[model samples]
Target: MNKFVYWVPAFIWIAVIYYSSSTPYEKQDIKPWLGDWVNLSWAGPYLERISFTYNNQEVSVAAQGIAGFIEFFIRKGAHIGVFFVLAFLIYFALFYTVQQNKNKPLLAASAWAGTVLYAVFDEWHQGLTPNRTPYAGDVLLDAFGGGLAVFVILSVHRKNGRKKKFNIE
Candidate 1:
């Protein structure tokens, strides 16, 4: 892969994230989230509600076993679950930024590192906001999501992830 191929998209995503996501953290007017970006609130809640409807009792049971554990940490001003899922998606979606390259380790590390850094910056951006305050728990949740993405990319696809081999003879 050409250096420009990877770097360009990397920079573009960074810029897009920096401009779009962080600013919202800095000033959560809610009009956007409530009126224009209402989809933000709606989508997140919708995903959860739909997931619940689909799973029903199984979700409750699983939540009681493991997901319910999050209750111990959740509180006002911090939505850990939302942040986690958002991070997971951000990282996962970002995977499309680069085409497959020869350097497996580098590519994996870049994807993960970008995710982790994005989480940190997102929190910092939130810190600058008045209505929204940055929470360490959120950052941790973000990291957890990012970490999960790595596993997902590796494991979620079974028959599709072809191993690349280099001829060294």
Candidate 2:
């Protein structure tokens, strides 16, 4: 029962991810709210200078306008931040549920692998949702988020001198 408790947070987070992915992109757009809250005219020149092709579409303030330009980054940042927390929750669950004496490196790797797999699943789900386009780059971003969380956890353990517990080999 206690082991099941350890897994609850990860499961809940997975559900939350699924719910978010199921929402149509039109419903999730926050550009109107952003436009109402602040003046972005001053940012136009700087944002306009930044432009790139993503998934065969041009992404720029000139193309999307100031509010949309800001929203674009917010959405991308959410992908990284959400996956980072998910990775940590998964690592915590694994730490308590896995057999004793396994090194922390193995646990962290497992958590990261789980995170990347979920990221792939999430993009696939988004592909099925209305107005949502799954980009491979977003999956890479999610993996980077998971990797970052593992790096921080390993660093903390190393700094605390838990050499035997955190050993890679």
Ten contiguous residues minimizing lDDT sum, candidate 2: 160-169
Clashing pairs in 1: 32-37, 63-68
lDDT of each: 0.48, 0.92
Top model number, lDDT: 2
Report the lDDT tens digits of candidate 1 across residue range 1-169: 4445535544565565555444643353333334343233333443344224221233332343222322223322233443344444444444555456634445445566766777688778866755555666566666666566556555544324443233222
Off by over 4 Å in 2: 162-169
Model 1 alpha-carbon miss at residue 30, Å: 4.8
Error of 1 at 24 (Å): 5.1
lDDT of 2: 0.92
TM-score of each: 0.44, 0.92
* Local accuracy of candidate 2 as per-residue lDDT tens digits, 40-106: 8999988789999878888899899999989989998998999999999999999999887768999
Residue 49 in model 2: lDDT: 90
- The alpha-carbon RMSD values of the candidates against the true structure, listed in the order shown, are 10.6, 3.5
**Ten contiguous residues with the weakest lDDT in model 1:** 68-77
